[model samples]
Target: MKAFWTLSASGELWQHLAISSWRALVGFAIGGSIGLILGLISGLSRWGERLLDTSIQMLRNVPHLALIPLVILWFGIDETAKIFLVSLGTLFPIYINTWHGDTQY
Candidate 1:
């Protein structure tokens, strides 16, 4: 499994991790914003909640990780693809947390 990816630069592991972290941070910001907007809507408005709540729940329930292959195919194993996947992973948690917080208020 590990052999699939090549770590070409022997001492570039730190740099690689840094790049991955930067991508994840970018993804987090984008995904978190979308999630917050969604969570706020779901928590604050009945119409908005009804419109998104089900779909969000449904999609979130699906193994988001399952989309990686499609993502890689669509975006090609680039920074965009990595960020997109990370963003997708970040979305639900932020949405869920915000929704919970909103409801608790």
Candidate 2:
């Protein structure tokens, strides 16, 4: 529709996208840092892997969309909850990929 196209091209749309992109970038960084630390710890200590591997795998399979209601219930509709979800979403992918990539053949 013309109205949808006009709205999509508006300055407000770009601003909203930029804000969302920035949050994604921040989430990526936070998650990547956590993943990297976990990777290093796993590499450096078998005990760390023993402690963390199962829980990370369990968390990986959780449906993120389904978490919104619970996250909002637990954390409320605030910046902290939004960022927490973003961080969790970002963290899982990196951790799963790293674990898969680095594991033995």
Candidate 3:
């Protein structure tokens, strides 16, 4: 497309792409770190599982879209909010997988 080519040639597209990549990477790191930590804790220890698994499972059941309004209210439509949403979106899956992997071994 001519428009796409124009934007790419101007560097605007790359800039936006880089920003998006950064956000995704940062969010994934934060979410993955927390998820892995919590998963390990829960998977390895009875007390940790008792304390966190039920709450995490319950929270996981709620839809991400349903939390958008609340997230906007809490975070106020900023980069932080965007990253938080991404991290929150990523957390449960990473946690569930990590926990399962840890427990299965």
* Whole-model lDDT, model 2: 0.77
Query: CA lDDT of each candidate?
Result: 0.87, 0.77, 0.93
- Clash count, one per candidate: 0, 0, 0
Q: What would the C-alpha RMSD of candidate 3 be, to one decimal place? A: 1.1
Per lDDT, the best of the predicted structures is: 3
* Cα lDDT, model 3, residue 43: 92
Q: Give a tens-digit lDDT track for model 2, residues 1-105.
A: 886678687857777778788878887788888987776565456787898888887878889998899999999987668777888877876776666666643
Query: How many residue pairs in model 1 have overlapping backbones?
Result: 0
| Global fold similarity of model 1 (TM-score) | 0.82
TM-score of 2: 0.76
| Model 1 weakest 10-residue run by lDDT | 1-10
Segments in model 2 whose C-alpha atoms lie over 4 Å from true places: 1-4, 8-10
lDDT of each residue in 16-72, candidate 3, tens digit only? 889999999999999988999999999998899999999999999999999999999
Best-to-worst ranking by TM-score:
3, 1, 2
| Winner by lDDT between candidate 2 and candidate 1 | 1
**Per-residue lDDT over 17-105 for candidate 1, one digit per residue giving the tens place of the 0 to 100 score:** 88978998999999999999999999888898889999999989878678878887899988898888788888999999998898887
Residue 58, candidate 2: how far off, in angstroms? 1.8
TM-score of each: 0.82, 0.76, 0.94
Report clash pairs, candidate 1. none
State the lDDT at 40 in candidate 2: 59
